[model samples]
Target: MDTQHDNALTHALAAIPGPVPPSGVLHVVIPHTSRFTVVGNHLAQHAELSLIAIGIAVYIQSLPTGTEVGIKALTARFPEGEVKIARALRELEAHGYLRRTRVRLTKGRVATRTVFCNQPGAVLRGAVVGAVPVVGPAVRSTTPAPTLVREHIHVPEPEPVAVPTAVPEEPRPVPEPVPVREAAHPPVRLPLRTAPTQPRRPLPHPRALTPELRQAASALLADLRRHAEELVLSEEAVEELVPGVAAWLERDATTDAIRRALTADLPKPLKHPARLLRHRLTALLPPPLPGIHDLAQPRRTPVTPFQTCDGCERAFRSHDPGHCRDCRAQYWEAA
Candidate 1:
């Protein structure tokens, strides 16, 4: 065994290169200054996680809170297709790095909620992330680690000396006392949160909406997905949002105008399609067209009534019935 160990060590020493060449991959790492996310090496270099899964995890971690992370949303955002993204998401979930749940909302609606863990193991152990490495591209280098050699030296032992029997002990001063902190209080119990008293926004009266306007509004809401895929609403959500869109139309808002208003400059990673439309509809509602009830009626000029001539029996404009202008002239001449 000793001979084998010596032979292996001699081979390793002889194989060490004297001149080190530059590696193909170089890291000019500049520490991130702002808007950065911390990822764990365990998850990044997972023994079982695929490359797609790691990339997906990093992307999700970098997003702001409450960002939509549905499989469809991710597939649309990334170059990967639906099947591959779905598979990667499942891989992440299997290894405890991702959690997906179907949350029941206040209404009878179910929403998909995604949660990401930067350090799954630490989370499982009920501890905070202490020393997880930041995310970076891993490069394999061909350079080998340098070997070290140590020299050994021996010296004679010296005779021990005996201690004096009557060595006097020195007195030590006590340290100043530190003020102790007060006793800790019991943890406060948080009160249960109640549902919102006013969840729905005030909408225009339903009676004001005509059948044609409702149909147009419903069609507009359903077609929003074409302009912005994130605005895709479920049937129930579309139904709930139709009235609000109808309110916009009741005020002389055209579908094109409303579409531009709702779809223009939409927020990134839209979490709630219905909620955003409801807000835009209510907030951007145009004032109803000028109606007689809304505006003062115009005053009409007084109009004179036509009268029949007494002598000529011809119709003429006068305060009372009289001869026609030609008949009046003739009558005047006769008088």
Candidate 2:
């Protein structure tokens, strides 16, 4: 959805109270008195920065100082994904408005700290900020500035040269120190990894399963070929997935159910047979059945108490002793 901030034209439109006039924008903005961050036009309107970078800078500035602004954190907050967010962050860093540094902490912990600068102008880049001394730590050696001053002092000059002593530099704004917080993910109620970078190792293979369970699981898999030729699995594939099918058996899911889960609705071409079986085995594996005492009672739908309509004595489900709608309509037509 698009959003716009209100301005003079929007206020003028409201005063004429007819159908709204056509314009390119409709404003719905309320000025932010609280929960707002100050952003300089230099960063916000930067010619070199991307739209993503500009928006991210605004978001980072609005967050509390220690809030996570790392690639992962921003990726979560925005839909632009890791690559774009990382690129935008690089843009911000290159412009001197953002910085990321990896710090090693106690107990083998390493963290990346992110900092945002509001106005990182050319003064910090060694060029003086117009006429004012901007109080930054003098990095004289890096620029040959102090050496040039000394050379100028030694020059044989007839007239006294008054080099302006005012060093127009602000205090070199150090990157803010911040502790990194890891992103939180909930348990089996949710997936441990929301997005896996690498394909997960196929579920605990047949080796850990008992001989009896493995034998049964293998039989079920081998039987799938008889039901559908396309459902064929290699001996190695069967061995690999024996544990997964065994998991279903352990959950008290029947062999027939497992077969149905695997073979039903086979797609056209049915190309990677073993891969299909593996996916079904993992995804459709039933949860363990509860003990008899904990088993859910069969749900019974409530039967509405049948009522006799006053006009027709017809059975209906209302509590009031009133004529049915059809009979009422008939009487109105007669009148």
Candidate 3:
């Protein structure tokens, strides 16, 4: 029975796989009493510090000694942006987990060094008591630590010697007062005056029109005013309609012709006069006939003049003189 048991044990040991070979990768050993461990626990239990602040503190503590821990570097390690990383660093500093001091370099330049503390502020203060503060960047060392140089120095007591007594000095007499002379000339005073007000000038009237055309325009406006409830014509609307009425008169259409065309075949209630007028004026106009002189001459295409834009200074083909389309849109927006 013992021999059978030994054979079974040997078979089980043979069936197991061999151990993995070392990859030569170096590893850092974190002791249980390290400041990083203590700070990490404190951060985990902290109620004031946010998750981002806690994570940033842990990342700073885990970095190798003397490593550059700038905002750019922190942003690259984490998914957050530079602003967020900077805010998190500030939060860490507020909680006494980190500090940064500007250090002067040997080459007449300046740099910032970040110091991380794992222990609380009280504990850290006690540890550095009676010792000069560390100035350079913090780094790990294999050699023994150096002794701290104290800031206070002891001085030897002076030898005891005999001294003579001092004498008191006499007081000086006061001088007589002198009167000051007045100025020969005095400043002159100027009288204040009120500004005169000017009367405001009246606005100029629109361009002059012929009596016949003006009478026709007025008759059309009066007809629309009579049906004001349906027309909804304000003073501005009447002014706008005068131009269209003048155009009809130039085509030899009488006021009576326009009134009949605009008011004929109307619905019981004229809900929209503007739409009806626009349609009649556009559709009822007779087709233009060619003039005798125009018919005799050869037809020629009108040439578009090149104009420079006031805003962009670029040349473009246009009949009207002003800014280009893009500049005009921008100007209207500003207005």
Candidate 4:
């Protein structure tokens, strides 16, 4: 730093919103000032120094005297240095106080470095022209331009323009009228709305089963009937077992027929032993065949009979076995 510049910095620091005493003064009054002013200027008193200035001073004091310094090198002098210094330097650059450039060394090598100084006139002009001032009109123009003038001219009247007239339309000829004839018979009257014929409801019919599925189901029924006693199947069981058996039989060589057969009867559960047989049959089938019997039938609540219970002296609706639940329990206890 130049001695005269240092002296000027000390003077500016004194002018800051704080009290400045002589060099040997015991106490100095410090005032709140923006960080930029504190860091950029030097101080005469201890209170005049900002925390950042103190930190920078300590960093500079640590380096050897007369050492050539660059902005990055100066910023990195502290152990806790970070990219923030580069950012602050950028702000300083925007203010025209800092700059970066490459310089050729005496050893035929180039070195990149940052320099700090007051902004030049051209840079200041660019900034002032760029910024739209808040107070008063801006001092600079947006672009360079020369003053210009425009002129108007007067002329004498000349010849008048001619106007053309439109032609008239021609008259149209009249047409001859045709003769009319009367109707032979009087018009007939019909009722406003005719009654709609009711559509015939579909007739109640036996379940539709494909020929191949029916044959397979028949074969399964024959097998089940042969072993009915062992399986404990009744009439209801026969009805339920047929669809599942059809699906299982069609699972391999006749999957398409089985799919057609089982799609509507999906969700009817098989008995335990029959379910095991179905599983074995599924394992023997090829890939992409129709799924096994979906024994999951839509749940229906059993109809509850409305009855008066003699034991409980209450009317209740129930799907329970012959005796009401309470009576059944009491009878079992007495037994």
**Which candidate leads in lDDT?**
1
Q: Score candidate 2 by TM-score against the native.
A: 0.32
Error of 4 at 279 (Å): 39
Superior candidate under TM-score, 2 versus 4: 2
- Give lDDT: candidate 3, residue 168: 65
Question: For residues 1-335, what per-residue lDDT tens digits would candidate 4 score against the true structure?
Answer: 69999897777676656555567544334675432222223221323333443444433323333344444565666554555444444443443333567889997999765443321233344344453212211223334321110010111122354647768668555432222231122222334576898763322112345677766665655454343333434455455556555545544445444333323332335445444434333443334353445545667987878877778756678655355678878999999
Which lDDT tens digits does candidate 3 get at residues 192-260? Answer: 566778653322122455777767776786676464446655566566566566666666676677777
How do these models rank on lDDT, best leading? Answer: 1, 2, 3, 4
lDDT of 4 at 66: 36
Tens digit per residue, CA lDDT, model 1, 89-191 = 8887777667777889987999776666665554333322132322222222232111110110111122355756886789667543333332322332334
Tell me the TM-score of each prediction against the true structure: 0.32, 0.32, 0.30, 0.20
Error of 2 at 5 (Å): 14
In terms of lDDT, the poorest run of 10 residues in model 1 is 146-155
Which is the leading candidate under TM-score?
1
For model 4, the stretches where C-alpha displacement exceeds 4 angstroms are 1-72, 118-335
Candidates 2 and 4 compared: the better one by lDDT is 2
| Clashes per candidate (backbone, < 3 Å) | 1, 10, 0, 6
Q: Write the per-residue lDDT of candidate 2 for residues 38-101, one digit (tens) a residue.
A: 5668777877788998998777655553566677877888889897788787777676667677
